[model samples]
Target: MERAEEGFGGGGILRQPPAVWATAGASVVAFMGIGLVDPILPSIARGLDATPSQVSLLFTSYFLITAVAMLVTGFVSSRIGGRRTLLAGLALVVVFAALAGTSDSVGQLVGFRAGWGLGNALFVSTSLAVIVGAAAGGSAAAILLYESALGLGMACGPLVGAVLGDASWRYPFFGTAALMAVGFLCIAVFLKDQPKPARKTSLLDPIRALSHGGLASAAAAAFFYNYAFFTVLAFTPFVLDMSPYRSGAVFFAWGVLLAVSSVLVAPRLQRRFGSLTVLGGSLVLLAADVVVLGYGSHTTAVVCTVLSGVFIGVNNTVFTELALGVSDAPRPVASAGYNFVRWFAAAAAPFFAPKIEEWSNVHMPFVVAGVAAALGALVVRVRRGSLVPAAVEPAPERVAPEGAEVLAG
Candidate 1:
C-alpha cells in the first residue's frame, strides 16, 4: 500500500527539489506568453491599423502551429533529451518574441506569433513530464504544482501586458522575449539533461495513443472546453472595452481566482465527487456563465467573466490529470497526443469568435462558446465509463516512464 506521507495530503506539494522550482519558475514565464497579449489586443489592432478579427489571427496562427507541433514535440524531446529541448524552445521564444515586437504590420505580428507557438509547444509538452519526473510524493502533487504555475503566470501575464503595453504595444513582445531569456538561463543552469527513452517516439505515436477510449474521450472533451476557455481569454477584453489598466486589473482578478480555485478547491472537489463528475459539473456551470456573460450588461459581463475563472480552473486541473493518466501510454506521449487533439480548438476559438460576432451579433459568440462548453459537458457525461481509470487516485511513487526522466542530476 502507498504510504500516507507520499500522497498530496502529506504536504509533499510544497517540498520540491531545486530542479522542480527552477522548472516551475520557468513554466510560470512560459505560460505567461498565453495571456500576455490580452491587455494589448486593442493596442495592437490600432497600432497596426488592423481590425479586431485581423489581430485575433495572432492567437489563431500561434495556436494552429502549436497544435500541429504537438506531434513533433515528443519526437524531438525523446531524441535530444528534455533539458536540451527546453533550452531550444526557450531560445526560439526569445528570438521570435523579440522579432514580434519589431513587426510593422499585423501580418508580420501574426507570423512571428506562429514561431512563438512552435517554441511554446515544445516547452509546454515537455514541462509537465519533467515536473512529474522530478517532483517528490506523487504525480498528483506534481500536477498541482504545474497548475499553480499556470494560474500564477496567467494572472501576471495581463498585468505585465498592460503595464508594458500601456507604453507601447511593442513593449509586451520585447518584455516576453527578455523574460523567456531569463527562463532559458535558469533552465540551462538548474536542469540537467533527462534520460532519453529506450525507444525514440515516432511522430505517429501520439496519433496512435488516441486509439484508447479514455484518452480519446478526454481529448474530445478538452477540444470543446478549450473553445470556451480561449473565447473568454481572447474575446472578453473587447467586451470590457476598458483601459489597459482596468482590463489588466479585471483579468488579474480573474486569474487570481483561477489560481486559487485550481490549487485549493479542485483537489477537494475531485476527492469527493471524482474528476469526471467535477469536470462535467464545472462545464455546465461554465456554459451557463458564458451565455449570461453574452446577454448581461457591462457590469454583469465583468462579474460573470471573473466568475468563469473558477470553472475554468477546475476544468484545467481535471482535464490535465485525465490526459496524463487516462491511457497506458508514456506520460509525455500521452500528453502530446492529448494536446495535439485539443489545441485545435485553441486555434479555432480566437478566429471564430470574432468572425461569429461579425456575422451575427456580439452576443452570438458567447452563445457559441456556451454551446461548446455544454458540448464538453456532454462528452464527459457520455463517456464517463471510459474515464474511470483517470477518476481513480493515482498511485503514490509513480515513476517516470522509460527515457522521460527530468531528474536534476
Candidate 2:
C-alpha cells in the first residue's frame, strides 16, 4: 500500500496538494447542488401552481436517479478514468442545471433534476477515491478534506438558493449551472487523470461488495440515517413558513455548524470516543433532536433544526470512513455499494415527508425521522465488533493496483 506518509499530528488537514484542493473545491460545488433548492421549494411550488408533494419531487427525482446511478459509477470510472468521469459528470450538471432554470413547469424541473443527479453520482463516488490516492496527508486527512467540502457546500447551498431564489425561483438553477461550470474549469485545469483500478469494475461489483458483514451493516444503518438526514434538509423549509431568504438564513446557520463539526470536531471526538461510539451517540442525539422539532413549539422547532446539524456532521464523517474501510472491496466499489443503499432513503424522505404530512400531520414526519435515526444507531450497536477495528486503526491506504494512469508527483 502506498499511503501518503504525512502524520495526523501537526496541521495535516491544511497540507494537501494542489490537485487535492481542486477536487475538494469541485466536491464542494457538487454537494452545494444537493441543497441549493431548499430555500426555493416553496417558491417553486407556488410559482408553478403545484402542491408541496409535487414540488418535493425535485428531491425525489434527483436522489432517485443518484441512487440508481451509484450502481454504475464504478463501472463508468473504471472504464473512462477518474478525470474523464469527473469532467463528464460536471458537464452533465452544467447542461441539466441550465435546462432546469429554463423549465416552465414543475414536471420539467423534476426531470432536469434527475439528470443533475446522474452527474452528481459520478463525481461524488469518484472524488473520494481520487483524493485518497493522491492526497498529501494520509487517508484520514483525505477523508476530512472530503467531508469539509461536503459541510461547506451543504452550508452554502441554501444561502445561495435564498439569495437568488428571492428574486426568482429559477435564478438559483442558473446560479448552480454557472458555479458548476467554474468547477468544471477548475478540475480540467488542475486535476490529472487518476489511475484506474487493477480490475475494471462491473455493475455487480458494488452489490457483491456489500456481502461483507461490516459493509452491509454500515450501509443498512446509513439507509435509515439518510432518511432522518434528508427529512431535515428537504422537509423543514415547508414547515418553517418563512420567506425564502429567512429559510435560507436558518439552513445556512445549520450548515455552518454542520461544516465546523464535520471538519473540526468529528476528528477530535473520534480520537477520544472511537468512531462507532461517536457515530452511535450522534445518531441517538439526532433522533432526540428530531423528536423535539416534531413536538415542540415553532421557536423550539427552529432551534432543534439548527441543532441537528451537529449530530448530522459527526455521523457523515464516521460513516464515510467506515464505508471505505470496513470492506475488502476497492474504495470506489464499496462507496458505490454503500451509497446505492443509503440514497434510496434520501429519495424516499422528501417524497414521503409531505405525503405523510397530508396523511397525518407535520409532526408525524419528524416522528418517523426520529425513529429512523434511532434504528441507525441500533444497527451500529449490534454490529459493534466488525466496525470497531476501523475505529481502532487508521485505514491502510491502497492505490489503484496497476495498469491505470498515474498522476505525476
- Candidate 1 lDDT, 264-321, residue by residue in tens: 6776798789888899999999999999999999999999999998998888777877
TM-score for model 2?
A: 0.89
Work out the TM-score per prediction.
0.91, 0.89
Q: Point out where model 2 deviates above 4 Å.
A: 1-21, 131-145, 396-409
Off by over 4 Å in 1: 1-19, 131-145, 396-409
Residue pairs in clash, model 2: none
TM-score of candidate 1 versus the correct structure, residues matched by position: 0.91
Model 2's alpha-carbon lDDT is 0.83
Candidate 2 structure quality by residue, lDDT tens digits, 45-81: 8999998899999999999999899888888988989
Question: Ten consecutive residues with minimal summed lDDT in candidate 2?
Answer: 400-409
Task: Report the error of model 1 at residue 279, Å.
Answer: 1.6
lDDT by candidate, in order shown: 0.83, 0.83
Q: Which pairs in model 1 have colliding backbones?
A: 196-403, 197-403
